[model samples]
Target: MHVPDGFLDAPTSVATGVVAAAGVGIALRRARAELDDRTAPMAGLVAAFVFAGQMINFPVGAGTSGHLLGGALAAVLVGPWTGALCISVVLLVQSLFMADGGLTALGTNITLMGLVGVVVGYAVFRLVLVVLPRKLGSVPVAAALGALVSVPAAATVFTLLFAIGGTADVSVGKVLAAMVGWHVVIGIGEAVVTGLVVSAVIASRPDLVHGARGLARRTALRTGEVAA
Candidate 1:
């Protein structure tokens, strides 16, 4: 959900801004480890895909809308560090150029979608992978499960943020109910889309899919590596 300007007070906005900045800063340094000849281009593709996907918004509570947050998809296809960077750039562009989310709330947007979404999604993806069979096929399924949870997790985070800094004195309980409720539905759709995209990638180049690294054959990856 892209939060609008003035939704939160100055202190809360500043606080989230600091958190966002720190998160992006860390990602920038760590993402270098994740990026390479094959994966660098994948980062670009993921950013574009997420940008397009976010355009389709379904209403959630408190004037915020939920859409296909490609957190799980990106984290699965690319490493989490790079995925965070991909989404942070998308948020920056969306706020500055598209006016999709308020400029003042860019920090909150990044904090929500970039940091919280990617981190939570990636963590859950790894956890799910551990439980499932360690096959390339399981990568997509784990990603789907991650996508299902990440949306609501982000929503829950937003609710907490709103409760801490919401301009209107809305009831946290009601807000939580609405945000989580709608997000769960959105999450289901996200899971399906994430599964499909990841499945396609796995079918084509499982090697390029970061979450499939150990599972995807290294020899096959060498044979499958395409010119950058």
Candidate 2:
């Protein structure tokens, strides 16, 4: 969800701005390590894909809408640092030109969707991959689960920030409930889309999928043993 202006106090907005700036700075340096000639072009593609996906929002409760955050999808297709940068670029463009998100709340949107979303989503993806079968197919499963968790996680963080510096007199409990509740439904769509995309990439070129870098598909050998 793209937070609008005046939803939070100036101090809260400024604080999130600092946090977003720091995240972007770190991402800029670290993303270089994750990119190379073979993989660098994918970053631009991922950013564009996320931008388009986010434009199609589904109605949520309270007259708000939710769409694909693309954090997990990006982190799976590219690296996390690069993924964050991708999301930040999309948010910047949307805020300035599209008027899809608030200019003043850009930092908050970046912090929520770029930093928190990618960090948590990628972490969960890695964790899921560790537990699931070590195969290319598992990458999509991991991505789906990661996408599922990332949405509500971001929503919860936003609720906390709103609780501290909300300009409106809305109840924290109501906001939290609505945010988490509706986002849970949104997360399912995120999971499905993420899984489908990851699966497609894995099918054609698993090497291109960042999360499938070390993963390999297993086949049954003549002896009925699985081999990678």
Candidate 3:
């Protein structure tokens, strides 16, 4: 969610800002190992796609709107560190150019949507893959489930942050209920899009997808097929 200014107090915003900066710093170092000639271009394309996907917001009742968080999608396509960085870049551009998220609240958006989203989404994805059938087919299913859970997780975290530093005095339970409820619906959409995209990429260019790399190698070894 793109939090606007005045939603959180100065101290909370600044704390999130520090957290965001640290997250980005760590991601920048880790992403280098994840990106290469084959995956670097795909990472750029994924960022652009996420930027576009977030532009279309769906009404989620009570005048609140939700859009694709893109953390799961990005982490599936790229690695988690790069996915976090990709979303951070998208947030920066949106905040600076489109004004989608407020300037002062940029760090909050980054922490909520970029750091928390990517970390939770990727963790759940890996966890799901452990229990599901370990096939190329299972990758998308895990990715979808990860995306489905991550949205509400982010929402829940935001509600907590709001409870701590919300500008207005609102009922924490009501806010949590509404945020989680609407976000659960939004998560379904996230799951659908993530599954479709991950499946499509696996079909076409599995070599380029970070989450599918192991499966791609196994298929290549089994079938003696090489990716073009």
Counted clashes in each candidate structure: 0, 0, 0
Candidate 3, backbone clash total: 0
Q: Candidate 1's residue-wise lDDT over 1-228, tens digit each?
A: 889998998899999999999999999999999999878998999999999988887664567566788888888889998998888989999988998888889999899989888999999999999999868889899999999999999999999999999999889999999889989988988898899999998888777888998898863557576433
Q: Model 2, residue 174: what's the lDDT?
A: 96
Better of 1 and 2 by lDDT: 2
lDDT of 3 by residue, 115-197 (tens): 98999999999999999886899999999999999999999999989999999988999999988998999998889889999
Each prediction's TM-score against the native? 0.93, 0.92, 0.94
Error of 3 at 14 (Å): 0.2
lDDT score of model 2?
0.90
Residue-level lDDT tens digits of model 2 in 34-127: 8998689988999999999987887756786778999999998999999999999999999999987788899999999999999999999999
Off by over 4 Å in 1: 58-66, 225-228
Cα deviation of 40 in candidate 1 (Å)?
0.7
What RMSD does each model have against the real structure?
Answer: 2.4, 4.8, 2.0
lDDT of 3: 0.91
